[model samples]
Target: MTNKLISLLDYENKAKQLLPKDTWQFISGGALDETTVLRNRLAINQRLLQPKRFQHAGFVDVSTKVLGSIIQLPVMISPAGSQSLAHDQAEEATASASSRVSTVMVVGTAASRKLETVRKVSNGLLWFQLYHHGTALTEMLIRRAEIAGYQALCVTVDVPYTITAEKDLRNHWKLPYGTEMANFTCDEAGLGIKSNTADARQYRRPPHVPVTWDTLEWIRSLTTLPIVIKGIMRADDAVGCVERGVQGVIVSNHGGRQLDGQASTIEVLPEIVRAVGQKCEVFVDGGFRRGIDVLKAVALGAKAVLIARPVFHGLAVAGDVGVEHVLTILRNELYEAMALCGVNTLAEVDRDLIYNCPSTAPL
Candidate 1:
């Protein structure tokens, strides 16, 4: 069955069939109207690669370092909350898959398994993704991650309020029973979700501690781990992150789950990269289903790209093997793309490798 899974879409299709209806809707749907979801893919398609075929590209080397961590490819798993919905093994299976490929995995704050369990099961690098619940909760989570052997702290700063995806609302989805965010004391954590009406949904928002540019310094003071700010799209925000001592920035739009009409992550990648790529590592994620999309991000100056939905699709279809297969397929596709573009190493990928047709068109 895995042999027939020729593309990432294949896994997506298979996973859709395998997962429960409410579970699939929660994982697949985006914000209200979902224009952002469509925009994410449309923006990526707009940038065409200027392949320099027949340059004796030879063996392609996709390995590179992202914020001092060595990954086998230019791809890393994005942090997505509540993994048990996808599969029973949850984040543990994902950790094993990442370790098998020697890439990094940013364990979500709402992961089904505890941070220590993920760290103990996987041999690869782990970065704890911090969603601020409060000063105390944030500090406790960070300290736990440090003790559990995580490599860095990726602070997700975009979600100021609870997200309200239409599909989730229509389905009245709630966090599955027995699923608890393992990073904190179950009673003190209070990170689990419960049912609520559509209008009252935003009002009954989860425990998302508000954070701003000022919060970065306070977080930095809490731990010595390298800070990677996620959910930054604007060039000024990227610049601000670098100026404020951040080690990395992830150019993302919350996988089109936050704002419904905002620009896609790919559409905003070049500007963010230009603003802070030199000073701090720039990463991106959103609508990146193909290896070619990964190549385009690197060419535009991203240190690496993160993938979440695709991996979830893999997990829903098969456990650890499914996740591993997803990574392998993407890695192989990226290799083919690199060779076709006549680039032997990630260093050879640059702005010249892509032709922005829209930018060159007559205004």
Candidate 2:
């Protein structure tokens, strides 16, 4: 009999072997030195866990509510684009898998499936991740996303300029033939994009307008889907979201994709949480691959956490089923970690369960 495959780390190893070198690099590479990429997870591991061995494990309840919706776990899928590179099922498969695990799916603007198709495919709650392409394209996408039944619109505000990963550049990675861009018309995306990516056959990050605090209102005007502003690394920005009346803030640095040397998402989570801990719900993601990491974020006051690359690895190996397994693995891990830490319910997790490590000391 074949041994059980219960861990996402096992799936990650399998995915690396199955995917092409270029695609693998694009999925994993961070900008420049990638110091922050390693820092993201390492920082989380630096956190010390004190076990209360005598406490009763009791009923393990990891369920938490985000943007007023309760989820089985604090983890959710971050919007990853170009699923065609990992598997043929693309966003449709991801949507189905996220639902299977009962976690919210954050669909990307660059998804291979059209916004409508992803909505149809999703079996659970959904959120649409937006790229600031220009007001017209942005508005149209928002309107369609609302019609498609997404619960929230996550505006990714960090990547104004593109970072061409050296691996994707060296590999000359290109999409397979017959891939389609379902959201926009063929004529709208004219060829002369500043982004150097050669594989972008039809689209690139929108160049017309970059996002600013002022841009939030324009997006608000488009639809009622609660806006979740992602890519915030500072406490001031977290506070800004509360002022803007946005529903949520993702404490992220684009998984260290945009600014290579910035603080790991874990390092900034506490500050952001402290800033708006009372004003709004804060979700954090970066270097968070373990159950302890989710607890760390919740202890620091995050309402939820997002896992970006691991989901891709799972998909590359087994499509929707793979992601489902990954989420379940994390859910189980969080349960065990919580029980070990002497807590059960999500609300029971607080600052007493966490402490900042001095390894984060000046280095």
Candidate 3:
């Protein structure tokens, strides 16, 4: 069955068929009307590619570096939580797949596997994704990740509070039995502390600690690892990240899961790239489905693109093998797309490759 899956969408369709309806909705649905979710794909599709016909390139190199770590391709796995919802192996399987493909996987704070346990399973670049629980808990998690041998700290600054999508609320969605936030102990997560009932779902409802730019500074003070700020959408905010000595900015809107009607990440990638201006690495991740999508982003100056929901699709379909297939599909598609566009390497991809590029137009 896994061998039949040819594309990411194929995996998605298969995963949907296999996963429970409520779980599928929780994984696929987005915030409010899900307007931004639709817009993310629309905006990427709207950006036209200018293919150069004459240049004959023998081979295309899709490899690139992020935060000084080399990857075989520009596509990477984004930090997503409750992966156990998709597979029992969960983050361990995802981590193993990432290693097999020679890419980075940002392990989520809400990961279903313990950070150390996930690390022990795979030899690959792992960046711990941090959700600010509080100063003490945040520091503790950071220290744990550092000791666990994670290379960087990807602090997710967007989800200040738990924003449940309409579909999730409609279904009264709850974490399935047997899956838990393995990173947090029941007591540390405040599970059963108040009600005396051990509800694992309490892990989703962490204290609302607003993550401001100052919060970045505080996190910086705590870790020697390079910091990558996720969920950045504005140029000024991206520039602020540079000022604070942050190493990277992932231009994401939380996969349109946090807010609806916001500008898509692709629509804002070029500006964020311009604002950062090589001060730090810039990456974008929203509505990236095909190789052409990856090419469009790289041409627009993104260091790389990260993917989230698709990883779940692969996991649900065939565990680690499906996850590897998903990454391979994108890498192969990127190679072909680059050849069509006469791009032999990521360094050759620039604004000129995009027709009427937004980066060059007057704002």
Candidate 4:
């Protein structure tokens, strides 16, 4: 079954056909205008892999460690909310497939399945993502994840507002009945969100709360888990995370669903990586649909890459089987790219393996 998927786009096409209209938009649509969404892919395609020929590179080893946890490949599943929209099995199926491939699955705060439930089913690394709904809710999730034995905490910092996607508005999309924010569905969780802070009111839509740097520090005080900040696009933010003792920083634009017209994650990764230096591990996501894209990110100094929509595409198409197939395809492609670039190990993959190659027609 895995052999049937020769590329990530195949999974996407199948997913589009299999999923309901509303569910598809929720997964595929970006923020207003979607310029940043398209820009993410364009920035990636513009970078060319400068493969080295006849260097006699041997067997490629794609395995690498993320904050001391070794994964089979440099690819990991990014956090996506309510995966139940993609498959009946939901996050459980995705977790099982991620474990089967020996990689990490950063469970979303809005996952349809509870974190513990997903953890119970996964034999692989699990990291819980948080949206900083508020002090109590944030603490509750951190404590629960710690109790459940999650390895790390990834705090999403970009979505200071709930900018409803344009496609969702057009389709009048809503979560199907029965699916819930498994972590916060209970009343005891306190609605799982708060109004945006005063400073962020201008940037946020109604009912969306902003988590400030002070809030980040507050979060850091509550748990001993290694905290990684997601949704960062600026070099200064990366530097600040390092200075404040963050364990990692994920260079992302919230998959272009938070801010429209912001620079793509790929476009800003190099600067952030250079700014952060070796103070902390740097990861990236957005517009990563191929093994070559993975290689391009690695060469630009990303420790590893996280993918959200592609995993959702696979889940919608063929459940766990599609997910495993998608991961395997990317791994195989990364292996091939490494061999062609005269690199036998992840360490050998650096800026030297890439060059600027402009593209005219990105669509």
CA RMSD per model (angstroms): 3.8, 3.6, 2.6, 4.9
What's the residue-level lDDT of 107 in candidate 2? 90
The numbered model that scores best in lDDT is 3
Q: Write model 2 residue lDDT over 114-209, tens digit each, in one string.
A: 778888887689999998888877887887888778999999888876667666667885555445454553322333332323444455333535
Stretch of 10 with least lDDT, candidate 2: 187-196
Looking at model 4, how many pairs of residues clash?
1
Tell me the TM-score of each prediction against the true structure.
0.93, 0.91, 0.94, 0.92
Q: Residue 128 error for model 3, in Å?
A: 0.3
Question: Between the candidate structures 2 and 3, which one is better when assessed by TM-score?
Answer: 3
For residues 1-363, write the lDDT of model 3, one tens digit per residue. 888988888998999999999999999989999999999998888888999887747988999988998899999999998898999899999999999999999999988887888999989999999988888778878888888899999988888887878888889997765455666653334323322236544654556587987888988888789999999999999999889989999999999999898999988988999899579999999889999999999988999999999999999999999899999999999999999999899988998898985654231
Query: Global lDDT of each model?
Result: 0.85, 0.79, 0.88, 0.85
- Model 2 segments more than 4 A misplaced: 1-4, 53-57, 177-180, 185-200, 204-208, 356-359
Could you tell me which 10 consecutive residues in candidate 3 have the lowest summed lDDT?
188-197
Question: Between prediction 1 and prediction 3, which has the larger TM-score?
Answer: 3
Q: How close is candidate 2 to the true structure, as a TM-score?
A: 0.91
> What's the candidate order when arranged by decreasing TM-score?
3, 1, 4, 2
How well does candidate 4 score on lDDT at residue 135? Answer: 76
Candidate 4 local lDDT, 227-269, one digit each (tens) = 9999888999888888777899999998889889898888888
